[model samples]
Target: MTRPWTVRLAAGLVAATAVLTGCSEKQEANETLPTNGAAETTPELPPLGPEDFPVPAEAREMTPEGAVAFVRYYVGLTKFVAENSLDPEPLLQLSQDCRTCIRIAQSLDEDRAANRRYTEYAYEFTGYGPAMLDGETAQMGFLYVQGPITVVDQAGKVVTDRSAPTPVELQSGAVLLWKPEQATWVITGLTVG
Candidate 1:
């Protein structure tokens, strides 16, 4: 299913600079576009197109707790997946595990394990356009991630100050961040297609 609030995927153009393609964010009913007048402007960006999204609460600051949780989830998720052969848990977790998240989790798991330092993955954030707030637990990403990933050969060296050598098909995903009662910003749910 096409997420109502979808961030357009953009494989960074080979221009002098890289541009991430994502949602533009929408405005709320009580909200009004800034007219450079006495009416103050909100700090958030509107949603992209006409798609509506439920914005969660914003964190006053980037918490260390959040960072650790996310890092652990990402790394552990990567490792646990490597050790065991599961159904689609890896892919689901990696891709926010949406109902139809497309990329094969098992395939990625084996690849990461066998390759180890050989693999690479990239996820794009829509930035603060919509200034999404954290829900009861998770923070919804108004952003959509669509980026190219490359797996490096252990035998091969990466280009200094540049990307790796062997490029692979892009693994696109939409991810959301959630928090456990004790932990903060653990990825909650997602899908690939």
Candidate 2:
């Protein structure tokens, strides 16, 4: 006296439905319970602007380490913009009257507008010199190596290629001003080679 396969499947389905319904009802009951006025509310974060990037706590301090951290963050942000083909507004926002910074941003923007993108542009910070702190300004020397760059258009046509065998090494300096109001540093002068 064996039951048909369809009948067994129907019975199994009914049992599963009953179990699922019971679990769902228990879940609903738990969700309806009050928290005794101790509910936690998470504060909403402010909206990010075109130029906004998260500044680490270390970079916000007005110390030598902070200056180094800020420069590292700036270089990382620039790389991020180039890699993602994003607008260079974030880089521009961190500079005051830095001509080199402005030129870099403008070049990035022009390439973006022209549908040209870098394929293999990379930077490595080799070392950082001691930071010289003035009243509200800090200056530092940095050494970095830049890998050969290759830019291509949307149609895969090479726009600019500097694919040398050896990476180019550069020694550059930066002068940054601390803005207490914003609790951050801004590049006032920059020299890149």
Computed on alpha carbons, the lDDT of every model, listed in order, comes to: 0.38, 0.78
Please give the lDDT score for candidate 2. 0.78
In model 2, the Cα lDDT at residue 191 comes to: 79
Steric clashes per prediction: 17, 0
Off by over 4 Å in 1: 1-108, 116-123, 128-139, 144-146, 153-180
RMSD over all Cα atoms, model 2 = 13.9
Residues 121-187 of candidate 1 have per-residue lDDT tens digits of 4544333223244453333223334333444435665423223333333333223454343223434
Give per-model TM-scores.
Answer: 0.31, 0.69
Q: Which ranges of candidate 2 are over 4 A from the true structure? A: 1-53, 161-165
Candidate 1 weakest lDDT stretch, 10 residues: 48-57
